[model samples]
Target: MITLKNVNVNELESAAQSCDFILPIEQTAVWASYQATIEGRKPWGCFIIQQDEKPLAFISLIDFETHGYHYVRSMHGPAWLEHPTQELETQVLQALATQLKQADKNLVFMRVDTWYDNLAVPVLSTVPYNQTVIISLEGGYEEILKRMKTRGRRDVRKAMRECPATCMDETERAYNDFSEYYEVMVDTGKRDGFVPAPLSDYTDMLGALGKDHCRVFAARVDERVVGWSIITMHGPVAVRYYAAMRSDAMHMFVTDRLLYAECCMLYDLGVTHYDLMGIGNDFAPSLKGLNVFKTKFSTEIIPVAAGRDIPLRPVYYKALTTAKKLRKVLKH
Candidate 1:
């Protein structure tokens, strides 16, 4: 049997504290780091899955208002074993659809951005489609880097030679550089036709990470800033969460050296695997330069298989996605 209910802050926090996979985004640690911490108040929940009343898994989703519509963020979970039967996933999602409807009878639609593959269930009539990335982190970072093309290695070395960079864990004031990083991200997003996450999101992450759970690594050119990346550590995995470079100097490979340093620090921190995050595969699926940038420092590209979206109300899901596309257009 499956059940979903909006629990209180204490219960929500307890379930997260007990999670086994240590999902970097979904874990309790991140909520504090980014200051996006949630309680049973407003639109937040700890949806539980069980077997004979024994909790088998939990999905930590943040129910918040975005652009005036209800959205759910998968901080982590549907946490499960290596492989669960198709029937099991169906039950999980059905429970979710029921819960989402209960929470927001007035809520038009709810969106979940999960970075996990195969966790999606066709039984979920509430989701239209999932958009996100899930990179595998099952090996040592250096060995993965070695698998990159010869050109990738050269850029890594070139970035090292050209930039005077210093990489380390984040400090209280590290977010000051978050601005420089965000600027370049905005520029990149515009070029690619997407908007970047707001500054509040970074601060929320920092507050959630506090000083102990996450680290921000940066690259500087002669006391002038060039590039930066954020990594969150949970269990044995280190996720390359976010990164950016100075628009003018990106061609100089500062981003490469910055990543190399991040890998080294992860090794020092005793992490076994690193997540390269996301890469798009369409039209220019094998986009030479961007692919070269990430693969050079890592070889493993975990195929995210395919995504599954469940829509509780098929009609609403269609309208929501359409409205979303139109909204993006009006913003620009």
Candidate 2:
């Protein structure tokens, strides 16, 4: 029988370090703490899924509510320690949902971001794009540049020659410049037709992750900050979490230089892979521009598995789903 054994946050971190596959930042304990800082979210502790005392996977759950209906979510996880077939995944998820329901009668469903190309089980919603670009940082800075497309290489070189400087700041003092970065993000959202998260969200993320694992890189021209990016490190990999630039500075290609510098810095820090995050997939047509921009840095695109929601209370889950659809339609 499968059982969920609760563990402390430190235990979760230690387990993640020794896990077989790379765990997403969202699955980390630090991320759970960061989520707790956001309003209307709560950390439900970490757990180890075991069958007959043999450990299978570790997952950190976060509690969330939508339209007064509470649900549990595990983002980009149950970081499996060993490869499992689709049947195993389905069994584990079913056991997890059953265990979770027993623990919290209020939970209507369990949302999980599984690392599978497909699943036999039912899912409430399908992820449109599970693909992202990853750049290898193995062969040093010059080799890294050689791997990029011609346009990416040219832009980096040009920006390096023209920009005053590009640097990564991981010091505690760097938090002081967050307001300036938030301003750029606000402008970026307006220009891109998306809403920016509150400044506190970003600030809390940096704080929760701490300076050793997270940092900000900025590109400047004549002492003025033109572009900036936030990166988080885990084991041998680093992820580019967020980035924004002053719209007028697009011609300067500061973003290109900024990311190049960040790559060099991560390589120097012993990171083997740099994940540029999501890009356009067939389902997400709106991300085409993002695909064009991110793919310039690396030709390699990795496809990940989609997320699934296992509903325990079918009636409430159906009601919640219908309400969400109605809300989206009303907004449109």
Off by over 4 Å in 1: 3-20, 29-43, 113-151, 161-172, 175-198, 282-289, 305-309, 322-332
Model 2 compared with the native: what TM-score?
Answer: 0.89
| Model 2 agreement with the true structure over 155-204: per-residue lDDT tens digits | 88887888665555544545765787788899899899989999988898
Scored by TM-score, the top model is 2
For residues 1-332, write the lDDT of model 1, one tens digit per residue: 67664565456557656754344454353452243453321435665567677666656665556455554545345655344566776666667777777766645443443333333433223222222222233355555356555776677777667766665555455755466656766776766666887876776676667556667887766666566777777767777777776667667667777777777777777777677755645522433335645655544566432334545566776776677678889999
- Model 1 C-alpha lDDT versus the unseen true structure: 0.58
Model 2: per-residue Cα lDDT at residue 30: 73
Provide TM-scores for the models: 0.73, 0.89
RMSD of 2: 2.7
Candidate 1's TM-score reads 0.73
lDDT of each: 0.58, 0.78
| Model 1: ten consecutive residues of lowest lDDT | 123-132
In candidate 2, how many clashes are counted? Answer: 0
